[model samples]
Target: MFEYISSLWSQFLSLLSSFNISSALDVLLVSFIIFSGIKLIRETRAEQLVKGIILLLGIWIVANIFSMNMMKTILSYFFNFSVIALLIIFQPEIRRALEQMGRNNFGKKLGLLNKEEEKQKEKKQRCISAVVDSAAYLQERKTGALMVIERETKLGDIINTGTVVDAIPSQQLICNIFFNKAPLHDGAMVIRDGMVYAAGCILPLTKSNKVSLELGTRHRAAIGMSENSDAVIVIVSEETGQISMALNGVLTRNYTRETLQNALEEYLSSSSEPKTQKKIPSFRKAKKS
Candidate 1:
């Protein structure tokens, strides 16, 4: 045992001796990648998968230590084929990560640099202002409104279910679309690339059983859409005039016009800014007796 420990120590020292600037850079690059991957999947369904994978890895390590050949062999086979399994299981997350990477400054400069990229900041700001103004208008009169803001995940499928408007957003235009008596009042409006892409769109209803019974179809649909994609869904309740936002499967309610604008701006600018824990206020409906 002493000899084994001595040999291990010698190997470790030898590795340290060979480490140079290139080795340090290689370690840093790998560490950055791992950190970025974890950050990408944070608070997502992929997080649970990572936990499960870690648990299985622990079991496999223990099995090997104890010479439990059958268990070790099974886990070995599973791990050997894990590349394909990971690809299949993490498809959505992988896509999102790649999309985010492509949207970043580095990727933009590398491949997608254009006038559109240069103008996105200004355009998105205008859209946020218009949406906030419209939400305030609808909230005052208790007129229901559902707006889905497209992010990295393309919402082409959702947009196809509705009538294409493909026009610049304005307060008047948005309010008119959800004016209760309007033709598109009952359906959702999808905002894409800072334009009012579609209206009278059908959104998927949430499968979650834990949603409050008080929430109507619009809110459920908003939550459902958020669950499937990274899009931000803004909702104005017809009954209470409550303003709510759904993101990453979490529904946060009770946003005023000011708060709504700030939240939207923050989330919209997330790609350009350093990520931090910006907690939007949350509220749960009171249960009936």
Candidate 2:
């Protein structure tokens, strides 16, 4: 046994010695590919399927070594067809992975240049101003309104629940929607890409224990929607005529027009701004409250 192992070790050393720089590089590249592929499949639903495939391959290797013809033949046939089967089973995840890779590449190409970032900041300010003005108008008129601003996460599913208007956002349009006699008075409005995408959209209600009883269904819905997506929700109470804002499931109440505008700018702005600017006034002081 010692002599046999010595011979095998000698053969391995000889093979290694014969490998040139290109051959060594090829081995390294292949190893990296396998390692990355394994890592990508791990912790996913694909992991179990991959394990099954590996188990079958192991069994086939053992069968071949033992000269078990039938077992080897069956395993080989299953292995031959597994490529198509795996693709079918993991299609969605595969597509998502590819899409993520494409986005990463695209984002790298866009390289956060200062000018482009400044333009985005400007656009966000415009949107914030529009929303704040609308909220102030609605609060004064006692017009109940729910406005959701989309953030990082896509609100495609939520947006589908409402009518798709895709109109340019304005204070007048928003106030009209929540007016006493308007058809969409009861439903929430969704804003995306600085546009009012839809109105009369129903939002989910929050079930959190931390929510205050002072909040109505509209406020609760705003909080609920924010909890699910990174959306900013502005609520104008119909009964109290107070303006409030919700983000990350937390509701801040009694926002004055000036404070509301500053808060919107602060929250929506991509760059660092003064923290003091975001502070909202006490709700109790507001006449609407």
Q: List the residue pairs that clash in candidate 1.
A: none
Count clashes in each candidate, considering only residues at least 3 apart in sequence or on different chains: 0, 0
Worst 10 residues of 1 by lDDT: 279-288
Candidate 2 worst ten-residue window by lDDT: 278-287
lDDT of 1 by residue, 31-84 (tens): 999998888677566778899999999999999999999999999999999999
Summarize candidate 2's per-residue lDDT along 48-114 as a digit string, tens digits.
7778878888999999999999999998888789889888977845754554344233553456668
Best-fitting candidate, measured by TM-score? Answer: 1
Runs with alpha carbons beyond 4 Å of true place in candidate 2: 1-110, 113-119, 271-289
